[model samples]
Target chain A: MNPQFIMDGLVAGAMIGLGAIGVTLTYSILRFANFAHGEFLSWGAYLALAVSGALGFLATGLTRPIAPFSFGWSLPLALVIAIFLTGLLALVLDAVLFARLRSRGSAVIILVMASFGASLALRSLLEFLFTSKPAYYTKALQIAVRLGGGLRATPDQLLSLGVTVVVVVVIHLLLTRTEIGRSMRAVSENPALAGIAGIDVRRVIRFVWFIGAGLACIAGTMTGLLVQIRPYLGHDLLLPLFSAAILGGIGSVPGAMIAGLIVGLSEAGAVQLVGAEWRSAVSFVILVLVLLLRPRGLFGRPA
Target chain B: MTGASPIPAAGAPALETRGLVAGYEPDLPIVRGVDLSVASGELLVLLGPNGAGKSTLVKAIAGVVPIHAGTVSIGGRDITALPAHRKIGAGLAFVPQTENIFATLSIQENLQIAAAVLPKARRAERIAAMYAQFPDLAVKPARLAGSLSGGQRQMLAIARALMVDPPVLILDEPSAGLSPKIVADVFSMLTEINRAGVTVVLVEQNVKAALAIASRAIILVEGRIGHEGAAQDLLDDPILARLYLGTGQAMEARRP
Candidate 1:
C-alpha cells in the first residue's frame, strides 16, 4: 500500500469529518437531511474570498503567510467573519422557510424537498456572483516536511488536521459539559418532552444552525486553503459528507467524525486501486452497504 | 359550572382554565368549552374514558396544544398564550403520557435538561434532590432513559417534571400502561409528591387508584364536564361512573 494515499485520505477526511458533523447535527435535531447545508460551505468559501480581498487593502501584512503555513493572517480573519456570516445565512433561511413550514407541522418529505429547492437557489446565487471560474486565497505553495515511511505533508494540511481536532474537542465539550448541549440532546431525543421540560425548542434550533454552519464554514475555508475555491466547492463534497454522516449514525457526532475519515480513506484507496473516476462512487457504495447491513449506523440508537 | 367561578377563600387556585376549546386541527375541537380549577396544594385527578378528551384538555392547559378559545391561569397569573417550554418557568410543568422522558438522554441528562433554566449553582442540588426523591433513578443515573422499564420511565418522567420545583404539575395519563402493582406504587408516589407541596393535576383512567389520593376529581363525558367536585363524592356516586363511561342516559338522569 502506498503511504501517500493514506496521508491524502487523512487530510481529506479531516475536512469531510468537519462537514459531516454539521450534517449529523441538523439531521439529529431538525430531523431532516438539509440538502442546502452544502451551500453553507459554498457561502463560507466565497465569503472568505471576498473578505480576504477587502482586508488586503486594510493591512498589507495580513495578506502574507504566517510562516510554515499556506494560510495568511487575512484568511484567518476572513474565516471568523465567514463563520458568523454563514451561520447567519443559515438562520435567515430557516426563519424565512423551514421554521414556518415546521410550525405548520409539515412532513419530513416536505422539508427535504424545500431543502432541495434551497440548495438550487443558493448554488445558482453563488454561480451568478462568483461566475464559473475558480479562485484562490494565496496562490503560494508550502514545502512538505517528511514524517516517516516515505510520507510527507505540507504544514497547511497538518494545520487543517490540528484545527479539525481542536474543533471536534470543543464540540465534544460543548455537548457534554454544558446545559445548552444537554438541552440540544434532549430536544433531539424528544422535542415535545424537552419543550415541556422548559427547553426552548426554537432557541435550540437556532443554536444548532449556528454551530453546524460555523463548523462547516471552517471546513470549507480549510478546503479552500488546501485546494482552489470554486462555486461548486461544497457541491462536490455533498455525497461523501452525507455518506459519512449516515455511516456514523444519523444523530451521533463522534460517529460522523470517524465515519468521515473512513469514507475519505476509502475514496482515496479507490482512486489508487480502481481509478480516480471511481473515487466518488466509493461513498455511495459504503452508504448502500451500511443501509443494507447496519441501517442504524455505528453509534445511532435503534429507531 | 358554566359561569365565572368565585374566588376561593384560600388564596388562589394553583391552576384554572376557563372555556378552554382546543384540538389538533381546525373544525375538530377535542376539548370543547371546559372549565377547571385546582386549589393550591391539591391533587386533582381528571378522569374520563378513552377519547373523552382528557389528555387533550391537559395538553391544552400545558400549552402543548394551542387553545382555539379560552384562558389558562397558573397561580392566578394568566398563561394561556405561553408556549409549553415557557410554562415551566411560570411555575407549571407537564409530564406527557408517552415519550415523557428524553429516551436517548441518560437519566441524569433528562433531569439536567429539565432544570436547564435554573441558576447554575442550584442545578446540582436540584438533581441530587430528584435522586433522593426517587431512589430508583439514583442507582442508574447514567443509564439511558430508553433502557428503563415502563414503571421506571414513569418515575423518571415525574422526577423530570419535579426538577423545576414547579408549584403546579400536569400529568397526562402517567399510568396508562402498567401492572396493577406498579399502578399502586405510582399513585402512592403521586400522593407523596403532592404532599411535598407540588399541586398536581393528573389525568388517569385508573379511577379507583386515582380517587384513593385525589382531593378533587373532574369526569369528562365527551368534550363536556359531566361531573366535578370531591373525589370521594364522585367515587361514592355509582351514577358518575355511568355518566363518565357514557353507558346510558337512564343512570345519568337518576343523579340526585
Candidate 2:
C-alpha cells in the first residue's frame, strides 16, 4: 500500500474524469458511443503545440516559469486556443458527417462504425503532421512536494487537480442553472418531447458538442502536461475514458468523475501488484466486471 | 359550450389545415385530403376508432408528421413546412400521445425546458404560474416525471405544453389509459383551459366524454372525414354514432 500509488492515481484520475464527461454526454444525447472522441484529445494537444510554437516569441516573458511551476503563461494561452479549435473541429465533424447520417436515420451501429473510421483518419493525420515521437511542453522539471501521509506529487499534478475542480464546478453551474443545460437533459431523456416543448434540438446538440469537445481539450492538455504529449495521447487513454464513462453510468457527469477515480486507482494498484506492462489491461477487466455485475453502471437507470 | 357558433365569424382561425395529405412513408398516405378549421376559443374534439387516422391528423396539424401536400396555418401564418421544433414559435404547442414528458427530469425542470423558447427574464414567472395552475405538480416539484402516476404524468404533459402559452393547444389522446375518474377530471381540465381563451384540438376515442365539452366535433373514418358537425348534434344522431364509432347501441342507450 504505497501512498505514492494513490497520489499518482488521483492525478491520472482527474484527466480520465475530464475525458469521460464528454464520452458520457455524447453517448447520452446522441445515443451512440463515439470512438472518435479520443481524437479530439489528441487534436487538442497538437493544436496547443502548434500554437505555442508559432506564438512563443510574442509571450517570451510569459513563457518563462515564475516559480515552482515548469510551464508558464504561454501554455495556458495555447490551451485556450486549443480548446476552441478542438471544439470547432468536433462541430465540423458532426455537421459534415454525423448530422447527415443521423438525419437519414442511420442505425446506432452505423454511427459507431463511422466513429471508428473517423478515429483512424484522425489518428493517421495527427501522426503524419506531428510524427510518432513524443513532444514536451517545457524542458525544465519540478521537484515533487511531499505531503504528510508519505505521499508525493509534482507541482503540475497538484495544479491539474485544481484545474479539474474549477472546470467541474463550472460544468455543474451550467448543467444545473442554465436553460440550454436543461434543454440538453430534456433532449437526452426524450428528443421528440424536447422538440415539442419548443427547444431547438439541433442547437442543443451543437452546444453539447462544444462543451464536450472543450472539456476533452482541457483533459488532453492536462495529460500532456503530466506525461509527454504524443500522437496517441488520446489513443492510450481511450479504454480508460470509456471505462470511466460506463462505470459512472452514461449521462451522469459526476458519476463519470467518481468512476474515473476508481478506475485510476485500480490501474495504479494493478501496476504495483502485477507490473507496469499490465496497467492497460486493468481498464478492460474493471469494465467487464462492472458490466457483468451491473450493466447499467452504478448510477444509471435500469434498461 | 354545446351550441358555440362555428368559426366565430371573426378573427382568423386559430388553426387551419387545407388539403392536408401526409404519411410516415412517401407513397403510402395515412391521412389525405383533410381540410379542417378551428376558431379561437373553440374546443374541437376529433373522434375515431382504431386506424381511423385520428392521431395522424392531429400530428400533421402539429407539424410532427410530414405533410406531402397542403398548408397548415396558425393565425393566418403559413407554417405547413415548418419542423416540429419551430411550430411552437408559430403560436402552437402539441402534446403527443406517448412519452409526452421528459420522464427522467424533475417536474419543475420539465416546465423549465418548455419555457426555453421564451425570453430568459420571463422563464421564472412562467414556471411559477404553471405551478399555480397545476397544484398537484407544485406539491412535488422535485419528483421525476417518470415516477408520477398515469394521471399526474398526463397533467404534467399538459402543463408542459401550456408553459409556452401558445394560442393553439393540440393534444393526442390525453385521456388514454387513465382511470375513468381521472379521465373525467382531465376532460374538465381541458374545458377549463379552453374557457381561459386557449383554443384546444383534442383527438380522443372516448366519444361521449369528449363530445360533452367540445364546441365542435369531427369524426374520421379510414383517413377521411366521415362526419362533421356540432358536438351535441353528433351525439344526438344514433345512426351517425353507429357509422362513425360502432358504439351506436351504447351511445343511444345513454341518450336522454
Candidate 3:
C-alpha cells in the first residue's frame, strides 16, 4: 500500500479515536449509548460556520483564511462557543428528558429509545436551521506538508491531531486527579453505594453529560474541519464511533481512544488495499470479528 | 424475658419507630405496628428467625424500604417523608447486608466519599480519626474495597457509615456468614462503637452473640414483636430461649 494512504489513515484514525473516547466515557458513566451524540458534531460545525460568516460580514479582510491553519478566526471562536453551547444542550436534554425517565426507574432499553428520539429531533432541527447544503469553514486548502516515506498531510490534519492529544490528556487528568473524578468513578461502579456514601449521584450524572457532550462537540468540530460540514456529519460517523467504544471496552477511556485510532487506521488501510467503496464496511467487519472472538471487546472486563 | 429497663426520660431516643408498618410492596406490610426505641449509647439487637421482618424494619428506618404506615423519627424530627440521604443527614447511618461499599473504590476513597458532606478542611481530620479507630483499615487504605477480605470490607462499611458521625448506626446482620473468629471481632467492634456513645441497632441470625452485646433485645415472629426485654432475661428464660433461640433441642438434652 502507498505511504500516503498510511498518513491518510492516521489522520482519519485520530478523529475516530477522539470521538470514540466520548462514546466510551458516556457509555461507562451513564450506562447507555447516547444516539444524539452525533448531532453535537453538527451543532459544533454550524456554530463555527455561523460565527465565521458573521465575522466575515463584519470585516471584509477577515474573508481570507488564517495562516498555518486555513480556517477563519470565527471557526476557533465558534468551536469554543459550540463546546459550551452543546454541553449545555446536553445538560438540558438530560434534565428535561433522561433524568425524569431515570427517576421513574426506566429500563436501559427505554433510555436507549429516548436517545434515538433525541437523535432524530436534533438531526431535524439542524437540518431546518442550516439547510441541507454542504458548507465549509474555509475555502483555502493549505499546502500539504511532506513528512518522510512519501507521506504528506495538511496543516489542519496536524492541528486536529494535536487538539485530540490535548483534550485526551486533560480528560485523563480530570478523571484520575480530581475529587469529582473519583466520585464519578465511584458512582459508575455502584450508584446506590455512592449515594449512601454521600457522593451526590445526580451531580455526577450532570457532569458526565457536560463532559461527554462537550467532547462530542469538539470531535464534531474537528471532523468538520477535516472534511465537509453537513447536518448529518455526526450521524455518518456514529457507527464507527460506537464500534470503537464497544471494541475498546465500553467504559475504558484509553481503550476507546486506542480502539478509535485502530478503527480509523484500519478503514484507511482497507480503502487502500481494496477500494474506497469498502471503507465504510471496515468498522462493521471489525465489530463482528471482535464480538465473535472476544465478545467483551479489547478492554471490557468480564461481567 | 419481660421487663428490660425502658429508655430514660431525659434525652431523646437515638432512634424511634412509631407504629411502623413497612414492606417492599405496598400490598403487603412486613412490619406491622412495630414500636421500638433505642436510647443513646445502647446496643439494641433485633433477633428473629427467617421471614421475621428484621431486615425490612431496619430498612424502613433507614429509608431504604417504604414505610406503609407510621413514622421513623431520628432524635426529635419525623423522617418518614425524607429520602435516604436526608435520613443520613438527620444522624442515621445504615450498613446493608451485602454490597455495602463502593467495591471499585479504594478503602480511603470509600471513606472520603462517605464524608462528602463534611467541610473540605475537616475531611482529613475526620478520616484520621476513623483510621485511628480502625487501625487495620489504615494499613491498606489504598487497597480497593472489593479486594479486601470479607471481615475488612465489613469494617470499611462500618467505618464509611461512621464518617458522617451519625449518632445511630444500623447494621443488617454484620456477622451473617463470617467465621466464628470474625464474628467475635465484629461484635467487639459494635460494643466499642456503642461504648463511644454511638447508638447501635443490629440484626443478627446469631442469637447468642447478639444477645451477649445487646442492652435491649426484641424478638420478631412473623412481623410482630413476640418477645421484648433485657438481654440477660432473654438469655436466662428457658421457654423464650427454646422458642426463639433454636436452643430447644439443647435445652431438652440438658434437662435435670
Candidate 4:
C-alpha cells in the first residue's frame, strides 16, 4: 500500500480538525448544532480568494509565489482579512437570527433549523456570486518533496499541518491557562452558574462566534490551498467536520484534533481498500458507531 | 469589586427588596409582591411549605428569575434592573440549588472562574484565601468538581460565591441532597461567614437546623410573607409548626 495516503490523510485531517474546533466550541457553548458552520468554511475560502485576486489586480508582483510554497505573500495577507470578515459574518448571522431567537427562548430544534436555513442562504449566495465553477489558488504546479519511504508532500500541505499544530496548542493554552478560556468552559458546563458567578454570558457567546469563525477561516484557506475551491467545498465537508467534533467529544480541543485525524485516516484507507465512491460514507459509519457505542464522543463528560 | 462598593455601609440595609414580582415568564410570576429587608451581618433563613415561593423570592432578589416589578438594593444602591451577572459586582452573590459547580472543570478552575471579576493581580491572592478557608479543596485543586462529595461540593459552591467577597450571600436549598451532619456543617459554615460581616439569606427545607444558626426566619405561603420573627422565637412557636412547617403531627407526637 502507498504510504502517501498517510500524508494525504494527515493534511486533510489537520484541516478538518481545525474546522471542527469551531463546531465543538459552538455546540458546547451555544448548545446547538449549527448547520450553517460549514458555510463559514466556504465563505472564508471565497473571501480570501477575492481578496487575493484584488491584491493581484493592484500589483502583479504581489501574486508572485513564495519560493517553496504554491501561493504568494498576498494569499497569506488575504487570509488575515478573510478571517476577520468571516468572523464578522458569523456575528451578523447571530445578531440577525440566532441572538433574537435566543432572547425569545427558542428551542434547540428551532436553532438547528435556523442554522440550516442560514447555511442554504450562505451557500446560495456563494454560488450566485462566484458560480459553481471550481477556483484555484494558483495554477502553477511544483515538484513534491520526497521524504523517503515512498512518502511525499507539497510545501503547502506541510505548512497546513504545521499551522494546525500551532493553532491547537494555542487554543489548548487559551482554554486551560487564560481567564476567558475558563469562562467559556464554565458557560459551556452550566450557563446559569456562569452568570451567577459574574460571567457575562452574552459576551462569551459573541467571543465564541468570533473565534470559532476565525478558526474555520484558517481551515477553509488550507482546504482551498490543498484542493479546488467551490461553493460546496464546505457543504461537502459538513459531515466530516461533525464526525471529527463528535468523535473528539464536544468542548474538547485536543479531542477534535485527534478525532479529525482518525476520520481523515479512515477515509483515506477506505479509498485504498474499497473505492473512492465510498469515501464520504466513512464519516457516516464512524458517526453511527460512535452514537451506538459512545454518544459522549472521546472526551465528552457523560450527561 | 473595584468601582462599585462590595459591602454595604453603615445605616444601609445589606439587602432590601420592595414589591418584588418574579418568575420564568412575564405574565406568570411565582414570587408575588414580597418586601423583605436583611440587615448587615445577619443570618436569615427563608422557610415555607411546597410551592410557597421561598426559592423564587430569593432567586428574584439574586437576579436569576425575571423581576417584573421591584427595587433590590445593596448599600443603598438600586440594582433591580441590573443583570444577574453584574449583581456580583454590586455586593451580591448567589448559589443555586442544583448544578452550582462546573462538573467538568477542576476545582481550581471553578474557583478561578468565580474570581474573574477581580483584578488580574488580585486573583491568585484571593484564590489563596479560599484555599486557606477550605483545606479539603486545596488538597486536590486539580480534581473535577463533579467528583466531589456532597459536603465538599457544598463547601466549594460557597467558596465560589465567596470568591468575589460580596457583602450579601444567598443560597437556595444547599442542603437538599446532603446528610443531616453535612447539613449542620454547612449551616455552621454559614454562621461563621455571617459573623465575618457578610449578610446571609438561605432558602432551607431543613427548618430546625436552619433556625439553630439563623438569627431570623421568614416563612412564605404562596408567594407572600406569611410570618416572620426572631429565629429563636419561631423555633418554639407551636402555632408556626402546626400551620406552615408541615411538621405539626410530628411535633405533637414527639411532645410529652
Candidate 5:
C-alpha cells in the first residue's frame, strides 16, 4: 500500500532501461551478449566522477546547484566527456577483442566467452583505478516534492524519467528516420547483405559501439546520481539488464524501456513483500517465465 | 545513377575479373583462377555442380568473399581493391543467395537502406522507381519483408539491387528455392532489367528456366570454367548432364 515502492521502482527502472539498450544492441548487431557492457556503466560513472571532481576544482562556481537539482553545470559537462570516453572505450574494446575474433571467424560461443573475459578485465581495471569504495555525484540533500495521489519524487528522479523518455524517443527516430540508424538496422538484420548494399559494415559497428556505450554512460551517470557508485554497481544490475533486454525482445528500444520498468517494479515489489534478499530472484523469475510463455518477447523482431 | 539514367561505360565489359581466387579462408580457394568477362547489357548465367564455386566466384567478384588473388572491374572501373560497401558506388550491385533482404525491416526500410548510397534528392525518386517496377511491394511498403511470400521476397531482393541503377548486378542463386511459376516471374524480371541495359550475372541451379532468358552461359567445374557458349547451345543433354555430374578429369587426377 506504500507509494514509496513506486518511486524506487521508477528510478531504478529508468537506469536499467537505458543500460538494457546497450545490451540488446550489442547482442543484436554483434551477435553476442557482451558481458563487458555492464563494465561500461561502471567506467562511465567513475569517469564522470573524476571529470566532475577536476572541473569542480578548476571552477568552483560549476558546483553550484542548478535550482532544485542536486548537481550543477559541472556534472552535465562531465557527463558529455564521460559519454565520449565511454564510447571510445567501447570501440577500442571491439577493435582489440571482438573485431579480431570476428576476423578469425570465431563462433558465437567464443565471442560470448571472450566478452566474459573482457568484463572481468574491465571491472578489475575500474576497481584498480577508482577502488571499491562507494562514490556519489553530490553530497547535497534533496527534499521530496509532492504530487497527487500521495506521490512524491525528487527533481533528479523526475529528470531521470523525463530523460529516459527523450532518449528512447530520440533513438526510435534515429532508427526510423536517419540514414545511419536505418543502416544499423540493416546491418543487424543481415550484415553481409547490408555490406553488399553499400553499407559500411565497420562504420555501423563503430556507430553501434559509440551509441551503445554513450547510452550506457547516461545510465551510469543517473545511477551514480541516484544511488551510490561501487565497482559492482553494474555487476549487480547485470541480471536485471539482461532480463529487461530479453523481456522487451532482443532489439526493440521501447520494449527494453518498458521491460526495464516492469523488472524494476517486480524487484521493488518483491523487496517490499518478501524482504530484499529475494529481489535478485525477481528478474530471474520474470526472465524464465517470459521465455517459457512468449519466446519472441514483446518486441522481438526489433524496431 | 539513381536520379539520372544508367549509362554503361562505352566499350567496357559490365563486369570483369582476372586470375581470381577466393574463399572464406585464405588457404582454401574455392574459386580458383577464374578469368571472366561480361559484356555490357548481357544476361550471363553461371551454372555448375555443387562445390564448383558458382556462388564463390560471384561472391568474390562482389567483394563479399575473401579474395586470395584477383582483380574485379565494373564498367571499366578497377574495383578489385574496393570493399564490398563501396562496390555499389562503382556501378556494381550484388544480391546474396540467402538472407538477401532485411527480414525484420519493412519493405520501405529495405529499399531505403539500399538507396542510402544514392544522393539525398535521388533517394526518394529511386525508391519510387522500385515501387513502380514491383507492384507487389508497392501495395505494402510498410509491411515486414520477412512475412512476404517467397516470390515476393525475390522481387524485393532484385528491386533492392536495382535501386542504385548499377550497370552490373550480380545475383547468387536467385532461383534456389522459388517455385516454378515464381522462377519464371523472376527470370522474366531479369530479362527486363537486362533489356534496360543492366548487365546481369545470375548463378542459378534451375538450368532450363535460367537459359530461357539468358543470352550466354558458363559452366564451372572444380573452380575452372569448363564450358562456355550461347545460352541455347547449352540446353542439350550433354551439357545438362555435365552440370549435375562432375567432369571425370577430377577422378582421373585423384587416381594413384
Candidate 6:
C-alpha cells in the first residue's frame, strides 16, 4: 500500500466527514433525511465561484491570488461569502418548501420526498446557470508539500483538514455548551415536552436547518477547492455522505464525523485495492454491512 | 372532609371549564358539556373508568385537544382559543401520563427547557428554586432523564412543570405504574405543592389515594360528570362509592 495513496484517502475522507456531520445533525433534529442537503454543497461552491468571478471582473489586478494561502481575494473572504450565501439559500429553501409542509402536518416520508424535489430543482437551476462545465477558483494550483513516508499534500487539502477540524469543534461546543443547543437536544428527544417546557421548537428547527445547510455549504466549497466544481458535485457525493451519517448513528455529531472518516478512508483504500471503478461501491458496501450487522451504526443509540 | 369551611374561597379558580365539549375526531365529543373548576391552592382529583374521557377533558383544558364547544378560562382569562404554548404562558402546566420526560436530556437540562419561556437571567434562579424544592433531584441533576427509575422520572416530570412556576399544574396520573411507596411520595409532594398555593388538577385511577389528597373530586361516566362533591363524602358513601367508584358497573348502568 503506497503511503501517498493513503494520504489521498485521508484528504477525501476529511471532506466526506465534514459533509456527514451536517447530514447527521439534520436527520437527528428534523427526524427526516433531507435529500436536498446535497444541493447546499453545490450551491455553496457556486456561491464562491460567482463571488470570485465577480471580484475578478471588477479588477483583473484584484484577481491576483492573495499571499500566504492564495485563491485570489483571500481564502477567508471567499469562505465567509460561500458560507453566508449557502446558509441563506438553505433558509430560503426551508421557508419556501419544508416549513410549509411541516405546518400542514406532512409525514416524514413526504418531507423526504419534498427534499428530493427540492434537490432536483436546485440542481437543475445550477446547471442552467453555470452550464455543465467544470470550473476552478484559482488559476494556479498550490504545489504539494511532501511529508515523510512518501506522502504528499497540497496547501488546499491541508486548509480543508484544518477547516473541518474547526467546524466540528465549534459544533461540539455549540451542542454541549450553549442554551440553543440544549433546546435542540430537548426537541429532538421529545418535541411535545420541549414545547411544553417553553422551548421555541420552530426557532430551534430553523437553526438546525441553518447549521446543517451551512455546514453542507462549507463542505461543498472545500471539496470544490480540492477538486473541480460542477453542478452534480454534491449529488455524486450524496450516497457517501448519507453512509457516513448512518454509520456514525443518525443524531450523533461525533459519530457522524468518525463514520465519515471511516467511509473516506475505506473508499480511498478500496480504490487502492480494486481500482477507481470500485470507489463508488465502497460506501454502499459499508452501509449494507453495518445495517446487516449493527443496524444502529457505530454510535447510534438504540431507538 | 365535606364542608371543611371552603377556605374563604381563595380568589378565583385557577382553571374553569363551562359546558366544554372536545374530542379527537370531529362530531364525536369525548368530553361533553363538562363544567368543572379547580380553585387556586386546591387539589381536585378527576376519576373515571378507562373510556370515560378523564384524560380528554384535561387535554382540552390544556389546549392539547380542540374544544368543539364552550370556554376554558385560566385565572379569569378566556383561553379557549390559545395555542398550547400560549396556554402554558398563561401559567398552565401539563405533565402527560407517559413519555413525560425528555429522555435524552439531563434532569437539569429538562428543567432548563421548561424554563425556556422565562427570560434567560431568571431561568437559572428558577431551576435553583426547583432543585431546592426537590433536593433529591439536586443529587442527580446531571443524570439523564432516561436513566432515572419510573418514580424518579415522574418526579422529574413534576419538577419540570414546576420550573415554569405555573399557578395551575395538571398531572395526568402521576402515580401510574409506580409502586405504592412511590405513589405515596408523589401524593405527599402534591400536598406540599398545594400548600404552597399552586392549584392542582389531578387525573387518577387510584381512587382511594386521590381522594385522600383531594379537596374536591369529580367522577365521570362516559363524557359527563356523574358526580361532583367533597372528596371525603364520595369516599365515605357506600352507595356513591359502589355506584361511581367501585367496579364502575353502577357508573356504566347510569351511562345511558
**Top model number, TM-score:** 4
- Return the DockQ of model 3: 0.51
Residue-level lDDT of model 2, residues B1-256, one tens digit each, is 2211122234888889898888888698888788888888889999876777888888888777778888988877788878888888777889999999888889988888787777788789888888998899999899999999999999999998888678888999998999999999999999899998989999998888999999999988777887899999998987888877666454322211
TM-score of 6: 0.93
lDDT of 2 by residue, A1-303 (tens): 677999989889989999999999988999999999999999998888888766677757767875788987788889999999999999999999999999998999999999999999999999999999999888888999998699999989998999998988888678878877888888888887787888888988998998899999999988988898998999889999999999999988888998998989888998899999999998999899989998889888777
Better of 1 and 4 by lDDT: 4
Query: Where does candidate 5 chain A have its weakest 10-residue lDDT segment?
Result: A294-303
Candidate 6 per-residue lDDT, tens place, A204-301, comes to 88898889878988888888888989999999999999999999988788898888889988998888889999999999999898888888888898
Better of 3 and 4 by DockQ: 4
Top-DockQ candidate index: 4
Candidate 4 residue pairs in backbone clash: none
CA shift of B255, model 2, Å: 30
Error of 4 at A93 (Å): 0.7
Those runs of model 1 whose alpha carbons end farther than 4 Å from true positions after fitting are B1-10, B245-256
TM-score of each: 0.95, 0.95, 0.91, 0.97, 0.93, 0.93
Error of 6 at A182 (Å): 0.4
What TM-score results for chain B when candidate 6 is compared with the true chain B?
0.91
Q: Higher-DockQ candidate among 4 and 6?
A: 4
Candidate numbers, best DockQ first, in rank order: 4, 5, 1, 2, 6, 3
lDDT of 1 at A214: 93
Where does model 3 exceed 4 Å of error? A51-64, B1-10, B249-256
Off by over 4 Å in 4: B1-10, B250-256
Proportion of true inter-chain contacts also present in candidate 2: 0.86
The global C-alpha lDDT for each of the candidates, from Candidate 1 onward, is: 0.87, 0.87, 0.83, 0.91, 0.87, 0.85
- For each candidate, report its DockQ versus the true two-chain complex: 0.79, 0.73, 0.51, 0.83, 0.82, 0.60
Candidate 2 Cα misplacement greater than 4 A, ranges: B1-10, B249-256
Each model's total of backbone clashes: 0, 0, 0, 0, 0, 0
Per-residue error at A33 for model 5, in Å? 0.8
